[model samples]
Target: MADKPMLDDTEDVALDFGAEDELDRQRRFRHPVAVFFHLAFRVASILVYLLCGWFVDSFITSFVLIVILLSMDFWTVKNISGRLLVGLRWWNYVDEDGKSNWVYESRKGKLKGLTTAAESRIFWLSLVVCQVIWLVFFFGTLFTLKFKWFMVVIVGSLLNGANLYGYIRCKMGSRKKMTGVATNFLGAQVWRSMLATATASAAGKE
Candidate 1:
């Protein structure tokens, strides 16, 4: 009798099909909030780098210390669960209504896949590379005193502008395809966005 085809009456339909799973995944996604936070932090980081450039008393020591702190914080996020920072625009997927959503990536990825740790490592590596550049610039300024911190400021400004434009556009129902913009800067994955949208919408109102 095919084992009587027994049904588990206690389980909610949504729970059975994994709506909770998708929500859990979406919670990990990154969005504009993450970008804003990074932008703010990077500004402070750049200032520290420039300060390092201006003063030579403890250049290397300061740089190393800062790097260590930043790396540790990033690694914590990379390893921890539920406490990861899911920024506004860092790792986002698009919804059908075309709104952008975010996740914490590596830590979040672990919930869904086998290579979560590897992905987290990669994410951390990228962050480390950026932080290293940050420290080097500061250290250089301290030793040489001839560095142009303005350039860093300008580039950061431009990146922030682009980020703002892209994030706002995505939110506003802009019919314009966000291909070149999000792709080049935000690591935008349209397919993932579509999947996120479908899943989110289907799970809603049901």
Candidate 2:
């Protein structure tokens, strides 16, 4: 018999299927424009709220500017950024019965591929942090006796808080949907298996 060659146990071997690279790319910010605007509006609102008093002489001008920025941020995040970056959207409507309802929607099936982990992190982190910042501003305004800025802080809090709450509900709704789907699938599979077993036992008895 021929002598067998010795194997090199010290060599490092790795299996690269390119899957990791693809996942890493998917986790990056694929939509630069969307990411830019997503951060831009929120940062602008915060900056205007904080520094407007120093630049603008009139309180009315500062208030109006902050409100405008807040409104713009709210609209952009609620309508545009949320949908584009996180594949989530939410809106409220009044029905014919004089009842209010909030609708939360997430991209399903193939549409979910449009979202990235980086974008989602940016969207949610900014949303939550902005709310906390506004809350701090709220208390600071109250304690400092800056009643004029209190209204501005309130507006900021409401607008940012609404988005935070809406997104939280949207996330919870998505989880519930997924859970229901999995439960239904498992139930169906169990029923099918039981039916198969029953049919097999009946055939054997015959």
Candidate 3:
């Protein structure tokens, strides 16, 4: 008889890791609308700043347009995108005693699981990249002695930097909170184990 086939008979299998990963990533962004706007405003601001001079002659007009786009990007990222995409938000307030306090919040309960890794990566990457781009613009202005555009770069830097800072703080706070909870749980377990051992020893000696 002819030798048996070396492998079990099965249907042809395709191993396209890249295509699988791309499909999985697309599925992870549960909120497509949020993702779209999160990227749209940020891209718009950067593009407008870079290309405005070619289309618009007036410096004042370019400045106003850029500022407006930056403002919109900042607001959308802080208010809508942060909450919907990453489940994080932060703000500062001053009390009557004149002490300023920063508040960081993360999603809790069942809703906490709604945030996907893909969405979070997109949110934070966009935030950090935009901030870095603005910094480059700032130094470009300084080195080239473009004083008129300095103010615009400064505004962009400040806005993007604030969001990046706030989100970073928020992320740290969440990590600390989780660490505390885990510590308390372990401490309780250890205490109970010790107490049970002491009780058993005392009873046995009686």
Candidate 4:
């Protein structure tokens, strides 16, 4: 008898078949489910922070809950949601020299050719809006002089800032790549023109 397929492998294959034409693979922003959860998680994180601080009236519990939710949101957005929504992914790692380096990867080929206007608009707008909201929350905490809440806001803001930086860097990389292509195209055109001129000069001499 043939060996049976592993349940895990079967499940994976089934899921792949279900989403065979994943929009992200086409570099299109068509993930209603992912986008829904992405926004839901972000909104829920802040709501929970507020609930713990105001309604529950427990400093320790509030602080812990806020930190955990924020952490989850950070990971989900950075890894899963960003990739699904924008076709961009980023990570940072420390080298043997103890220097940290960030890597930004973007989908290329036909997926890249599909373009990024819609994704970029949503991605950048979300970042800006999140930063602004977090900043407002930071000031609100400051008014209350709650050191713990302030700390939470600071951490959340830093995470948002880092995301913004990574995305901007990724976009810059795309721009540089495009610029290189344009330069090469112009150079080839110039070369072709030079060849034609030389050919004409030779014909005249002949």
Best-fitting candidate, measured by lDDT?
A: 3
List runs of model 4 lying over 4 Å from the truth: 1-29, 96-98, 113-120, 174-206
For model 4, residues 1-206, the per-residue Cα lDDT tens digits are 99997676443333565354555534565666666666766677678866664588677777777777777777877887777677778899999999999898887776764434565566668778888888999999888887767888998798877887776677688788899999999999999999999999999999
Superior by lDDT: candidate 2 or candidate 4: 2
- On residues 84-197, what C-alpha lDDT tens digit does candidate 2 reach at each position? 998889998999999999899878898897888888999999998999999999999889998978889999999999999898888789688899999999999999999999
lDDT of 3 by residue, 12-70 (tens): 98899988776785567788899998988879888988999899999999999889988
Cα displacement (Å) at residue 152, model 4: 1.1
The alpha-carbon RMSD values of the candidates against the true structure, listed in the order shown, are 19.4, 11.5, 10.5, 13.4
**Model 2 CA lDDT for position 176:** 82
Our tally of clashes for model 1 stands at 18
* TM-scores for the candidates: 0.26, 0.74, 0.70, 0.63
Q: What ordering of candidates by lDDT runs from best to worst?
A: 3, 2, 4, 1
Model 2 TM-score is 0.74
Q: Once superposed on the true structure, which residue ranges of model 1 sit more than 4 Å away at CA?
A: 1-17, 29-50, 54-152, 173-206
Query: The CA-based lDDT of model 1 is what?
Result: 0.46
Model 4 compared with the native: what TM-score? 0.63
Backbone clash pairs for candidate 4 read none
How displaced is residue 170 in candidate 2, in Å?
Answer: 0.6
